[model samples]
Target chain A: MADEPRKIAFICSKGNLDMAYPALIMGWAALGNGVDVTIFFTFWGLDLINKARVDHLEIPPVANTSMKMSMMGIPGNLGIPNIMGVLPGMTAFATALMKKKMNELGVPPVREYIQMLADAGAKLYACKMTVDMMGLKKEDFLDGVQDIVTASDFIDMTEGAQIIFI
Target chain B: MPTRTYAGKTVEVNEEGFMLNPADWTKEIAVEIAKEEGIETLTEAHWKVIDFCRQAGLASGKAPTLRTITTGAGVPTKELFTLFPKGPAKKVARIAGLGKPEGCV
Candidate 1:
């Protein structure tokens, strides 16, 4: 008897534009490998699935170390002064630059990326706790979400599967 | 110093059996490689995927992630698993004569 294919679970807790891609890309790859893949979006990460707002996720440059360095055209390891990250329009500029680069690399924007993941058969979920806290309904999420599940339920479902927190 | 002879050609392969030089691949080599992976026969569906992967690798200069094959090749995810079984990406890459896809795949 052959064993079942491997499983992979992704937990995404942050909502920044940069924080979102890692989980999405990995989930897609897991599906490619014929692995069972599940992703739970909690708290701010919930933004990745919210039907009304998921597409509008932003890149805030304030207090962002990498964005600051990139804005100054310096090596990523070099940090810019704190005052620079606080400048008005810095967030917009940072967001625009990152968006541009992703476009050039043929990476889909947020909405399409989620669609692709769903198309590839990766399961998406929303945190029930966050949903109640935010007074959100299931309808608030996009079409691909499997369900809004509690943390405990998610843990149980992912048993025996490799879990990755992003 | 490792090699595998397929289709009467002895070619360099890695420990995992992927061809060290993708250019060494041919249709006969694909048939031989598929058999070595426990697929006794490569069906049309399998060739569809292998052909897509080879073309994508040639265009991109790297192996296409599973995502690309599903979206670009139009093979649904479920069918991909059925065609290649476990370790689909690695298996397809090996048979298609491309490098292993990086990251989770």
Candidate 2:
């Protein structure tokens, strides 16, 4: 147990409501185990750090084969049909259902999770190329973001650390 | 399933040194365990967190996670890191004579 503390770096490339949690949950767990955690948000993943979108992330059911009715405690193994998912309010409905389940399980929302991770000292970085391409400034991100760094810089920073791309 | 002496009282502990039976814990045992964890002194702050963990663990049937500790015990996350160092959730569980916290944050 006295050996060097392990380090883990998570590359977040997706920004859906469901996609945002894997890194946050895993990073929090790693920090609890005394592992150093670093997260890099690139492309759509940058929306997780965008203050405007962080709290509004939605889970569209169109391509989500796992969005089954059983998740809502319905008595069937039926998945939400892609045709039904294309309705005007389907995305909102699905997002709300997921949020309800997460709340029932005592899971923190994405914004709060980011705050918790930052307070616990996990390093958060935004991908610079994405930031520039999206015309986003540092102020567009949440306070937890440490900096906007290039992908090469991220590699150099996480040298010898276990990397997980999600 | 190993027995060890803490403050001269025999208690069962796991391989990771977490007390197997929380009923066998006492303030003296906590002190000795804290020493082994390199915490020479169990400050008032430490005891507050420990007391919360024990009660919460009993109610939940599992050790409290770091988020539970901070929100339920009224200790901030930064302060918990400072108080228990390295791994606060794991260390606090071991010293409080509770099982390790589940890994799903």
Q: Estimate each model's TM-score.
A: 0.83, 0.96
Standalone chain B TM-score for every prediction: 0.93, 0.96
C-alpha lDDT (0 to 100) for residue A159 of candidate 2: 90
**Candidate 2 residue pairs in clash (backbone atoms < 3 Å):** none
Which residue pairs in candidate 1 have backbone atoms (N, alpha carbon, C) closer than 3 angstroms, thus clashing?
none
lDDT per residue (tens digit) for residues A21-96 in model 1: 9988777767766688889999999999998878777788667665446544665666755687678876677778
Please write out the lDDT profile of model 2 over residues A26-145, one tens digit for every residue: 999988878899999999999999999999999999988988999878978999899999999999999999999898788999999999999888999999999999999999999999
**Clash numbers, per candidate:** 0, 0
Instruction: Return the lDDT, model 2, position B73.
Output: 91
Model 2 alpha-carbon drift over 4 Å, by segment: none
Q: What C-alpha root-mean-square deviation, in Å, does candidate 2 show against the real structure?
A: 1.4
Which candidate has the highest DockQ of all? 2
By TM-score, the best candidate is 2
How does candidate 2 score on lDDT? 0.92
